[model samples]
Target: MVSFIPSKQLTNPQTVLPEQLVEALAHETPLAFQNVEPFRRKSALADGSQKFLLRNQEGKPVAVAHWASPYAPHSVREAIARVNSAKQAVGASLAPHILGPVGHGNVQGSSFGVFQYQYPLSENKFFWPVQRAQITPHLLQFLQEVARVTQVPVPTSEIETKFAAPLQHLSLMEEVPGEIRTAAAQALCRLERGLWAPRYVLMHGDFWKGNVLLTQKQPPEPKFVLIDWAGSKVQGYAIFDLIRMAASFKVKPKRLGENVAAHCQILGCDIRDAKSYLLAAGGHFALNLGCFPLERFVCMMQASVKDLDKALAATEVN
Candidate 1:
């Protein structure tokens, strides 16, 4: 447990951490900064929140903190939800241990939280798409563990609302290509008929390489820690996570389909049809990833549809 002291020199205008956030951290968490300056990172988007890497007096990295803008209550809410969702899934074994919220002042203005981990995240080397053949199996194992803990029976109405409705909406969008829209329409019809609606598992929702942190630990010891659980769901299509991971590699569409197929086998999911997997994965992403702009979402959906088409065509050729 580290003791914190808010230094006057560290409270200047150019400081990345807000004064309120600093106070919250001093009072709420056991992080010590004192004369140490935090390494700050602004959000890639205009989300008006910033992340800070706090260090101890000895210059050892200790905790990560997030400070949200006054207007971004949703960001704060998502932060809280992310912690709760991770805890509900299987506690700190699969994620960074939650240090709890800095203060309950999210709605009033800014919000803050801190997370501490023993091993530093492998920030640089985890993403090696060229070696996907070796990396994908570990990712599949992580996904299977997540599903094993979080799987539950989802009702049809929930499926329609969560997946089919978003797909129907996408199908009507003019910005989306005809092929993608047609595929979306077909997927919606299948949902209505109860196809691709069963065997729901908790989806990481954004299971890309960036969100996955590999510790410097050797193989046989636990190394993977999944972060950013804002989009996790108790009842979701596991194919969504599988496809998202494949897409992050920027693999060709047919290759992505093959990866998902192989991953599905590992998870014991029976989704073999390329079109069926595409529909379910696409619909799940379209519905839950509201952080993406409509245009961006449409573009992703178009690309995904094309990839799945290639995958299906390749399957037919074989």
Candidate 2:
């Protein structure tokens, strides 16, 4: 049996892995180690998903694993399968190859999912600043590939349903302006009505600089790779990923608008459609903002809301 530690205490990578995880890994993969040290805590999602990196006995970084609590075992299995499917669809150049799940079971009485680690393209911080010119083409190219491989069967009804939490929470916040609340509500309605319909595709779900890495820094042909596939989805709006990517680098509203326009041009879609999707995505973040307690989430929502309003205004005139 793997020894247990308080989840709260599992903060630093210096902490040793639970014997259970170590044994599980050794049993599943050829890789063996005498010691395991934490590398970093990647993310702990609102839904109780946790990611961690660990170094093996040889001091070589070996595995990165995601553990999801309070989830059905089948769901964890499904996520692994989905990650594998996504990796195959995009190829190793875009999505990193997962080493597959080593072991999974109850940890601290909550169900967990563990996966193999894949190296990121760039080890720099997620919010590391880079010139727009450097990343735009690569971002566009990724979107194009996603579009090419995925298909939209029918409009998703969850667009409006997903905003329910935001709307409900905002309604109780007297500090939030009535105008903001009304705008969010209206945006939700528009999505429900199929105004500014978006093409559904296989989405990275949490595309951002933090989840994206640079494999090759050579200009004009730089290679980029995406990580953190736990949130990957089959029928997701591309705009959600695009908006999150812009927010990750803290791009301002004007620049964000310009980028959205450029993206629309490349995809041959209406800018209004992108904006509508942005609005919905903003509300989704707003709902979850209280969960993570990160300032970056606030910044992202602010930019998303600002660009969303601008998009709505432009649509009204046209």
Best-performing candidate as measured by lDDT: 1
Worst 10 residues of 2 by lDDT: 1-10
| Model 1 spans with C-alpha error above 4 angstroms | 1-20, 35-47, 90-108, 117-135, 217-222, 250-259, 262-291, 307-318
Return the TM-score for each candidate structure: 0.74, 0.64
Decoy 1 TM-score against native:
0.74
How does residue 278 of candidate 2 score in lDDT? Answer: 54
Q: Which pairs of residues clash in candidate 1, taking residues 3 or more apart in a chain or in different chains?
A: none
- Relative to the true structure, candidate 2 reaches a TM of 0.64
What lDDT is reached at residue 133 by model 1? 46
Error of 2 at 195 (Å): 4.9
Off-target runs (Cα >4 Å) in candidate 2 are: 1-18, 42-52, 68-78, 85-136, 151-179, 185-195, 214-222, 250-259, 262-269, 283-299, 307-318
Clash count, one per candidate: 0, 6
lDDT over C-alpha atoms for residue 145 of model 1: 66
